[model samples]
Target: MKAVLVGILVGLATASPVSLHRDPWDPTIKLPSPTQQLVWGDVNVLHTTDIHGWISGHSKDVYPEKSWSGNFGDFYSFVTHMRQKAMTKKSDLLLIDTGDRRIGHGLTDHIFDPKKANGQDA
Candidate 1:
């Protein structure tokens, strides 16, 4: 119970709810300003899961979906920045990825295989 609460708090601190500019192509996309100030604790952890080969990002510019459409590289940059923030604050932050990277886009799920059915498995 406490862990869940901590997780929520940690997430809120690290991200602005809608963190990145997911779709720069869309002209009408409205991004919200980050209002939450980070309150780093002694220990913190960030976990990402259920990616399903979406390590790239959302290609189509759809509502709500576009909010989290940044690629893994973007995510890495975000985490790196946050980690730096934690270091300045003298807090410990850990990043954990529990995603099952399978079941994804054509480029990843298909592409090179002769069958094009089973991709590079874990």
Candidate 2:
């Protein structure tokens, strides 16, 4: 466990020094990408909150939105890599997701009660 913790600490140390910048064409928009080595520390944690069923990731088909898009698959890969690193040094790395779930999405939102003849378009 200590070994794992140490690994996690090392990975954490190398993470989080991402560059946050806006597109020159669109200053209102922002993009986040790791650009340098992160500061090391004794403890580290990763938490995700207020995500409304967007695990599928940002859309690339849509214009101007693909710049910062990364899907659940990518996220899993990152976590797995971190886990491997953590296992090496027996360090600790906790990931928490406070999901809002899928409620306002298109398919669910379009669900109409067609069972009754009450008439609502799905």
Candidate 3:
């Protein structure tokens, strides 16, 4: 009975590695699109805050993480597209970043000198 249990444990341990063959970085995965059409008014405001320098975005293939995919470039493209739409419609589109642009992720952490605290790189 002990030998059977030992063999089962060994088999489980060996099979555990196979189950862990999932890739964290899937390049083929696309970012999700908006489900519903947005109702744009004369004055449209796009607000972004507390980014903490996470420009690369969440790459995990999980629930909330997958929902928030797309990096800074993707966001910029989206803003550009919206701006174009607003221009064609003669509407005012405002993009606002309410502070907190530094000191959180790897992109904004430890990259500057000790003198720079608030992303002031001279």
- Which candidate has the top score in lDDT? 3
Q: Mark the 10 consecutive residues where model 2 has the least summed lDDT.
A: 113-122
RMSD of each: 16.4, 20.4, 7.0
Q: Candidate 2 has which clashing residue pairs, if any?
A: 3-89, 3-90, 4-89, 4-90, 4-91, 5-90, 5-91, 5-92, 6-91, 7-89
TM-score, candidate 2, is: 0.46
Q: What is the C-alpha lDDT of each candidate?
A: 0.71, 0.61, 0.74
Pairs in clash, predicted candidate 1: none
Against the hidden true structure, what lDDT does model 3 obtain?
0.74
lDDT of 2 by residue, 20-104 (tens): 6444346675655889865434455677665544568776644446654766788789889877777666778888865432333
Is candidate 2 or 3 superior in TM-score? Answer: 3
Which segments of candidate 2 are over 4 A away from where they belong? 1-36, 39-42, 60-64, 101-122
Best by TM-score: 1
**Tens-digit lDDT track for model 3 on 23-98?**
3356675656999998889999999877764688876777556756778999899999999999998999999877
For the record, the alpha-carbon RMSD of candidate 3 to the native fold, in angstroms, is 7.0
Instruction: Extract clashing residue pairs from model 3.
Output: none
